[model samples]
Target: MASSIHSPNQQLAYQQARQHFHNQQNQKIQIFWSNQTQDIKQMNDFKNHSLPLARIKKIMKADEDVRMISAEAPIVFAKACEMFILELTLRSWIHTEENKHRTLQKNDIASAITRTDIFDFLVDIVPRDELKEDGLGIPRVAFQAGAGSSSDHLPYYYMLPHHPSPVGASGMFYTAPQPCPSLAYMHWPQLPQQEPPKTDT
Candidate 1:
């Protein structure tokens, strides 16, 4: 019987192929939130205040569960817009020296939003715990390319306001995609046992 063989190079190639598949599966989903119309007033306010638009976007995106509602969505969009402004404002305040190096902690987010009555309209809407401090706190230094060593620390805890408690909610409000399984093993399969060629043929 002829035998099948795999060289070392072939094995290496197979491993690399599997890694590529896993990487592709783990790719994160990106959600974008932009102003529908040029709110000259808001733009001018931000510019004059030196608020960091880039950082704001980063914060929103980092929270994988939160998505940017489209401006055309009216109610939901409005709520998200309010949240954005409140978040930016809180970030600015936390970064201020008076905050004692805390940066704009997550708790600050809840406090700011609640104080501003941003999500007050929804019935039974309260602060959600899942949005609490991420433990990473705020960046000690400005964020720049190759600025400094990366820190794996979790963000600090902050307040999070939720409309429905996880227990009270009818169904889960946030739904995440299932993790994609690894495809590395797909390249190799067990060969089936075969009987010797028929001698009487």
Candidate 2:
């Protein structure tokens, strides 16, 4: 109801203020962490996560191939998952704030993933709206750090000594996937083409 009364500029200003406050809070948290040397359990105790470790373990064990897991595996996986969730949420919140909205939406998640390079692995999962004139959406190409060329995104393959293929059999070659281009570096406008210097050939 309050949204109906606020002008677009007002909403933008509000969002900017909110984002500034959150950024300051994050900086404070980082400073506090930097001052402390803590164990993993102590860190976990300091931060709250919503997901249950048992559920994550159940999901991990659902695969028939995964017969056994170490006792510490679930705890490690749970913490990793919690951190992942926090990162995604913070990134999506940035998008929401940019849009001048307090509520987070699915589009915000897509925008966040599209803008973050590390999240490029999820490019195939996010759906993009089709533009009729273009026939397709933006190309799903990402730039991999330290990769010599940007030809194609590929997966890595492993050769297990215990499960070696026959000598005459063809070996699988895996390609590595590229990380998505960061939007922080994507804000340049195309420069106007200058006429080539008039030269007498």
Candidate 3:
């Protein structure tokens, strides 16, 4: 018996399917920067100690026109303010790199917030139209030609955006594609359980 060859249409379909698979794999890889631990630690310290306790309290007292603040209010506010600064800086840095700019600019911060939906509440405060006026709508620098090297410290991951929390309001986190190892085999009573059926002897 002779082995059969694929028909012309079948060959074409196979080639197209293979090409589609490669395209889908490529799409799954998104480029992003690796975290800088030194910068994170420095920012954490600044968040904790950069603001004076007295000043935070003083500002709270000044808002007595329509509000009252407890002693713990200043502490909370200071911490929140620090986190806000760090969040904005991180977001702006991402945009700067995305625009292929080495320097972080005010406009980059605006663009980041504008592009991200979580910052929609701040849209009224940031000038969205000014991006075009300032020529920032276009990436400041073009990607280097013939630079197929992945030496730019770029990394890729599969993740989904998490809801805003006090600590992770930035929503940047990695979620593993597979089931968690620790919980994969755990059984819970809340889940439906089946007991062995008994038949009359």
Per-residue CA lDDT of model 3 for 1-201, tens digit only, reads 775686677767865765564455334322112223344444534335567878887756554353777766776677667766766777677657555799988777776666555566565566544323356576333224333334221222224456534345467553434434447568856967799999999
Runs of candidate 2 exceeding 4 Å displacement? 1-41, 44-49, 130-201
Per-candidate TM vs. native?
Answer: 0.21, 0.46, 0.40
- Report the alpha-carbon TM-score of model 2 versus the true structure: 0.46
Candidate 2, 1-201: lDDT as tens digits: 355776778767866775576677467546544543353435746234467777878878765559998867887787677667767777778667656899998867776676666776666686444325455665543334433223222322223356444553457643334344354468789899999899898
lDDT of 1 by residue, 15-107 (tens): 576456434422311111223233432443323223444544554555555688343344333445565665546433533322355466554
In angstroms, give how far residue 39 of model 2 lies from its true place: 8.1
Each prediction's RMSD over C-alphas, in Å, is 24.0, 19.4, 20.0
Clashes per candidate (backbone, < 3 Å): 22, 3, 0
User: Where does candidate 3 have its weakest 10-residue lDDT segment?
Assistant: 149-158
